[model samples]
Target: MSIEQSWNRITRTLAEHAPATAKELLPPAAEADVRAVEDVLGQRLPVELFEWWTSCGGGLHPVLPHGYIPYRPIGSASAWREWTRRHGDGPQKGSAAGLPGAGWHSRFVPIATDGGGYDLAVDLRPGPLHGCLFAFSHQWGVAYPPEWSSLTAMLGGVADALETGGPVGRYHAETTRGGMLVWKL
Candidate 1:
């Protein structure tokens, strides 16, 4: 399925079974906002990411609680701001070189944050893994293999997990007693 379709299914599932979490999703971002971040970063967002942001701005709170880390998708502006504020010049401590993992690399776009030092980023670095998604941890750095090849795959996995009660990577979809969606390991 297309990214948009997968996203729709995910949102629909959330709306029906996890209304509280569904309400936390942000509105679509304006075109100008996306452009502004691109201009600032001097990097173009991949088509899938662009499509995603144009349809869903991001999140106001953590929606995907993968394991213990509660990740919330971030808008372009927030991504750029975090890049500037944290990345600075080069890779940080515990960063793996040339790998799209935990580090302060300009090519890595911070698409989601755990509100801690860790992040979920899009790898812009040239290579086979370009455009793939990986989880960046402050302590562990980048996981060897990418979690998702693209935003499309990630959304599709999420939708499938919700529909089948399956696992997305290591995370399993679950609902709280209050009918809120949560992904646990």
Candidate 2:
């Protein structure tokens, strides 16, 4: 299914199972906002990500019960720049330096965060890994091999888990609060 269809399923499930949480879903982002993010980043966001932002602006959406806050337009641009400064090459790499192959690069753009320090990013580098979803931790570094091949696939997994009481991609269903299910590591 398309990301929109998958997200719709997730929202329907949330509305049925956790009405209050569903109410927290943010509205779609404006086209101008999305364009501004691209302009700032000097890169075009992957189509799936663009669709996601245009359909559902990044924030507290019920679909990601794991607290993965997808960055808003400006938030995304700023985050990529910040992560690049801290983890990308150069002397500013700082603490992230000398980590035995653990560091961020320019092509890896921050998409969502667990509201802690962990982030889910899109690998925009060329070649096979392009468009893949990666899990990045400030404490541990990027989880190699990625978490999902595409954002659409990841969301599809989440929808499947919600519908079947199963795992959501690499994460497992942890608990439920007020009828809202939460996924965890």
Candidate 3:
């Protein structure tokens, strides 16, 4: 299936569950938002990325909790802005729930796309097992533990039933750090 198709599936699933914990709803990164993405970096997204995004869907760190946010470079900017305005402070020392909760990185990477929203990227390679990486728009990750291992592995699961063709995964990251890296993959 295409990324949009997969996103529809995920969103449908979430809708059924309704009010899934903040960790359950995976986000969306779509080709429809290509204009928005292009606006952000002032460069067209690589064809490979478009194909990957249309096919692989958004970035979902499988190891994260169900409520964990996925990488969504598309959505309502106000939502993310509101989220930050209300909970801009990272996380506390011990708090686990709510915005600016403990272990979460502060500030989301701002992307200027056509339809503008946020981009949340998750790195799967490297060590330290698995952990939340990108957070833009209304989505961000916490520095908890990993149950998966790598972001690539998580993408693999989403593509298990995917048809042939298209890029292997969704958006890519430009750097590492604990914030939302630019979409390079």
Candidate 4:
């Protein structure tokens, strides 16, 4: 199936499971890890989402809903390596599995970069969930997420937020109600 089709299937299915969860939930320390990330970036992360990430039971990488992608630096460039090193990991193989740690590297993207640039709806992965897009938002120290279905729409939201400097890190996640959606950053 096409990436978009695959993304549609997973997201459609995950929508019914909003407030996405994982196998290994986050410990308080892991929450701190996420906080540290925000601190390092001089920005507050999506708290509720981070809370959800920490709630992972330990397997199946905790992920947001469709049309939302994580923003991270991934590359062999000096600046990228320096960025990763600053994050202080020992260097590890990468995986789309659980949230990565030391040694593991891959920027979380709710949208696909496609070697092109933040196409919020484009799924960069070549695998089954390849077309899945994700994003998050942060504003006034609080993050808002939204429900998205297409890359264009997701990018539009992100662009507006960035332009206004109002909020960021908006992402899609499983909700307790029934499914996931793009919400506060």
Candidate 5:
């Protein structure tokens, strides 16, 4: 299904099963805000990610929790800059050279985190990896190949897992107080 369809399914499920948590989602991002992020990053965000921000502005939601804080466009830019500053160089020379390490590539923009210093990011660099979704950890580095081809697919998988009680890879569907469904690791 399309990203809009996936978003609809996700929101509908959340409203039905976890209304309270759904209410916590941030307002849709403004176009200007998205532009601001692009200005900061010095490159445009992927179409899918732009669509996602415009449709559902990043915020706390039933499917994503604290460590998984979704980034508002501006927030994402700032966080990327900060992370680069703190971890620009690798711990061991050549150990993480040219790979995703302390100084992550400029093309990768963090979209969310696992609350344990790991991040879910969008790879915006050119070539084959463009638009791919990745999972990165501060300690372990990039988690192999791309996890999803696009943000739409990733969100769709999350929606599917929420609807079927199926696993979304390492995460599982979990319900908390007030019958709210969330993805838990």
Candidate 6:
């Protein structure tokens, strides 16, 4: 399914079974806002990421419950701030998952946050894996192999898990008595 279709499914499920979380979903981002961020970063967003932002800017809280790790979507502004915060911080040195770059690179645009330090980002770096999704742990650095292939894949996995009670990576989707979506390992 298309990213928009997959996201619609997720939102529909959330609205029906997790209204509290659904209510926190942000509206579509303005084109100008997105372009401004791109201008500052000097990088054009991947088409898929731009498409997603046009459909939903981000979320106001950690309402999404099906990422490889806990995360909430972040808007363009938040993404820029995150990129700036980690810019030119030197290469991440440690045993990594054999991924590109020394660790974090300027092209790794964060799209979601765990609210602690970990972020879910799209690798905009020039490579075969460009536009793929990966976990960015401040302590652990960039993860190799990526959590999902793309934003569309991530949303499709989430929508499938929500609809079928299946798994998105290792996460099992659940809804609380308080109408919030939660993921259980």
Off by over 4 Å in 1: 65-76, 79-81, 88-102, 138-145
Candidate 1 residue pairs in backbone clash: 101-142, 102-142
**Best by TM-score, which number?**
2
TM-score of candidate 2 against the unseen true structure: 0.84
**Whole-model Cα lDDT of every candidate shown, in order:** 0.67, 0.71, 0.36, 0.32, 0.69, 0.68
**Backbone clashes in model 3:** 17
How would you encode candidate 2's per-residue C-alpha lDDT over 40-156 as one tens digit per residue? 778888788888888777766424635687677777788778777777662222323122246777667777877787777777766665678776775555544577778898888
lDDT (10s digit) by residue, model 4, range 1-185: 33333334433344344435322222222556555555544444333324422432122222332332333322112222343444334223333422212331334222222222222222222334332333212111111122343333433444344234334344423234433233443
Runs in model 2 deviating more than 4 A are: 61-66, 90-101, 139-143, 174-177
Query: How many residue pairs clash in all the candidates, one count each?
Result: 2, 0, 17, 63, 2, 0
| Candidate 1 structure, TM-score to reference | 0.82
| TM-score to native of every candidate shown | 0.82, 0.84, 0.32, 0.25, 0.82, 0.83
Candidate 4 global lDDT: 0.32
Residue 34, candidate 6: how far off, in angstroms?
A: 1.4
RMSD, each candidate, Å?
3.8, 4.4, 13.8, 16.2, 3.8, 3.7
Clashes of 1: 2
Q: How far out, in Å, is residue 89 in model 3?
A: 1.0
Q: Please list the residue runs of candidate 5 whose C-alpha ends up more than 4 Å from where it truly belongs after superposition.
A: 65-67, 89-102, 138-144
